[model samples]
Target: MRIAMIMNGFPEISEKFLINQVSGLLEAGIDLDIYAAVRPSGSMRHFAAERYGMYDRTRYTRAARSTKTRVLDAPRLILSNFWSNPVAATRALSTKRYATAARNLKTLYFLEAFGKERYDIVHCHFGPNGLTGSFLKDSGIAKALIVTFHGSDINSYPSRHGTNVFRYLYERADLITANTSFTKGKLVANGCPEGKIAILPVGLRMEEYEFPKERVSRDEATLLTVGRLVEKKGHRYLMDALPSLRTRFSALRWRIIGDGPFMNVLRDHAKELGVSEIVSFEGTKNDQDVAAAYMSSTVFVLPSVTATDGDMEGQGLVIQEAQASRLPVVSTLHNGIPDGLLDGRSGILVPEKDSPALADAIGRLLSDKDLRETYGNAGRDFVAETYDIPLLTKRTVDLYESCITS
Candidate 1:
């Protein structure tokens, strides 16, 4: 079978899971070609293409904005990039926002890039970006189209547009996949047919994430959170909880891994709260380092929430990754987290945006050694059974076979 996987970027450190999926498909004896609108340049591009057998669709033209160009025309570029539509570029010019234009441009790019490719299945990784694949499928360019919803795309983009594009994609897609049941339910509530949606949590390379036997434990009880340092991640709320937590557990230390737009704001908040000494903003560690951080920490927390702009956690993969390292998780009932945690079984789930609850969960895990151990063991078992790459890859391959054969 020939499969075409599409996403916004290729070989991104944050999106290694997509690369893993493509690798899995290839290992399963399926011919796979990765398609992306933008790709990194120089040796990185060549290495990624060679490493993953990706076909360089982005090389069709150098029309995309460079850092210098983007800096100069930030506003105009944002507007044009957002509004241009590839499928109906001229038509989208009448629309108000730049997002529409950007979508058009992407669609146009895909239409050109995919014109000569013979793919049995065209699978996209997110919803808004899935628009291109969905359009191609609708236009009879691909034999079948499937989209895997990865949190924010479903929680934010579709809700903002109010267009039936998501529903249309859901209805037309050969299959729809969600990382957790919570996300699947969200999709159903948003009018996607329940029969079409599959609960397929993002898989992890267990071998690569194996808990180290000789991991050195830190002196202070450490709590960790790893992901993009964005508002929706609820890092601010975690920082707010620190002051109260410190009063009770003075030996507590907090480590936030990853960097983003909100880092400075979080840094300021930490200083204002006087917890600067205890909080460590370890900016964007690599995967092995992240696994080591998970091993060293007493507990992992993801106090995610629905941002003001409607952005939310679809399914927190970091929670699973932490659990895979045999660390107990402290998270919220936001989006698909509950589905991932199994509540009282694997980890504790508190109400979203509640620092008190967040603090309490972390404290509980810290105070009770047995409960923490039990939850940690249970979490590792849960990840092994559910999100292991080999098992997940097989299920994904089954879905692809069904889609192509049908």
Candidate 2:
């Protein structure tokens, strides 16, 4: 299958799931051309991205602050490097309209990218990009469209872009996949055709993780969470849960593994709650760093909750990732988290924003070694059975095959 993946950027820290999908697809005898609406802006690149020579295949749209900058940069970039990067140069030609050059130049970039390629499917990674997919098909790009809604696309995007933002995408796209049933529900609520949407869990790259032979103990008990420090990640509530947990497990250490806008707010809250020394702000660690943290940590928790502005987690991939590394998880029953876990069998699910419940769950896991081991082993088995990338990717491929035949 020939596929064009429309994405926000390459090598993004948060979008490793997409990278895993791409790598899996390639391994399954599918050919892909990665089309980034913007360039890879992050300093960290996934090991798979580097190994597969993806940088050589990636074509980026001109990302600029102003329309004048975009218009100027597009031609200059294409003209100067047409011989070296013929694909991008041909896609971003001088034939686009003045209005397009001023506003929505990325549309022109997208048009040109798919314009030159004959693809079996134009798969968009999020709902907003699915809007672009619809535009591409309407322009007579001979391919079916498939979109995957992971999280914020349904939670934050719809609310920000208006409820009818994806009306065209729903009507035109051949198929859609949701990361969780919660996200699928949100799409159906917003007028999507229910039959077209499939629930596809974003899975872990099993090779990259180590399934511990048995529960390993750390010298000093540590509780860890990995995600951008955002409102929905419920880091503040984790901070609130800490004071209580600290009293019981005096040597307990907490590590937060990503950075975002709420850094100052979370730092201040940690200090205000008098747990700064015990809590380490290990900002923006890479995948290898995370894999190591998973092996070392005593327990993993992602106390996710819905944000004030209606934003929520669709599927917390980190929950599964933590489980794969054999760490007992303590997370909330927020959104699609419960669906991702076997709950009482694999991990504990507390009510959202319930600091006492979260603290208590952590305490229980810390105090009972056998219980922690049981949950850890069960969690790993659950992920290995249900969330393997190859199995999940095959399901995605079946969706693509259905899109082609239907």
Best by TM-score: 2
lDDT of 1 by residue, 1-406 (tens): 8788887766666776776676677778877777776764323233333565555422332226454643454455334434643444343333233244234456555555565566788898887666666666655667898989987777777667774547556766888998878778778888889998898888777776675577547335799999989888999988889988888887899998888999899999989999999999988666667878887889899999889998888777788888888888989888878877768877998888898888888888888878887998899889888888889899999999989888
Tens digit of lDDT per residue, candidate 2, span 169-240? 788889899988889998999999999988998898766677445644454579999998999999998889
TM-score of each: 0.86, 0.90
Number of backbone collisions per candidate, in order? 19, 0
Candidate with best lDDT? 2
